[model samples]
Target: MKARIFVTLKGGVLDPQGRAIHHALEGLGFGGVNDVRAGKLIELDLADGTSDEDIDAMCRKLLANTVIENYRIEKAA
Candidate 1:
């Protein structure tokens, strides 16, 4: 089983790093750059029968900062 986690900043959070990245992209002549936010991706290969509840626990404990971001889990065969 494969688990893909997407961790992203919640709305209304200030992301200075993302802003800097956006500016750099603009300086490089990338057009149409509007807004930017940074996030994380975690891929886990686990044994079958791993529960969604357990995965949610993992995200809450270590994979994401609940104060600033939210996480979503995707399971793949």
Candidate 2:
């Protein structure tokens, strides 16, 4: 089984890297970007019997930092 996890900054967190990219985009003449957020993608290959509960635990333990970000998990073919 394949599990894909996406971790992103929470709404109130300040993302300096994202802001820099946003600024660069503006300099390049792109407009209408209100904000930017940075994130991480984690892919896991697990045994077929891995349960949803286990995956959620993995995210909570290592895949995401709950103090700064939120995570979403997807099961893939």
Candidate 3:
């Protein structure tokens, strides 16, 4: 099985990397960009019998920092 995890900072959290990217975009003359946010995409290869519960546990325990980040999981067909 293959799974993908998207991890992003929660609203109201400070994102220095995102800010830097936004500034760089403006410097490059790309206009009208109001804001920028950065995130992570994690792909995982699991055994065929891996359960959803285990995958959720993986996110909660290590893949994401639940306090300041949110994660969504998508299983590949």
Taken over the whole model, the C-alpha lDDT of each candidate is: 0.94, 0.93, 0.98
Error of 1 at 17 (Å): 1.5
Superpose all Cα atoms of candidate 3 onto the true structure and report the RMSD in Å to 1 decimal.
0.6
In model 2, which runs have C-alpha deviations exceeding 4 angstroms?
A: none
Q: Name the candidate that leads on lDDT.
A: 3
lDDT of 1 at 45: 92
Candidate 2 structure quality by residue, lDDT tens digits, 1-77: 89999999999999998999999999999999998888999999999999999999999998899999999998997
> Model 2, poorest ten-residue lDDT window?
34-43
Q: Candidate 3: misplaced stretches above 4 Å?
A: none
Ranking by lDDT: 3, 1, 2
Report the C-alpha lDDT of model 3 over 4-62, residue by residue, as the tens digit: 99999999999999999999999999999999999999999999989999999999999
Q: Looking at candidate 3, what is the lDDT of residue 60?
A: 100
Q: Which has the better TM-score: candidate 1, or candidate 3?
A: 3
RMSD of each: 0.9, 0.9, 0.6
Alpha-carbon runs more than 4 Å astray in model 1: none
Give the TM-scores of the predictions, in the order they appear: 0.93, 0.93, 0.97
How many clashes show up in model 2?
0
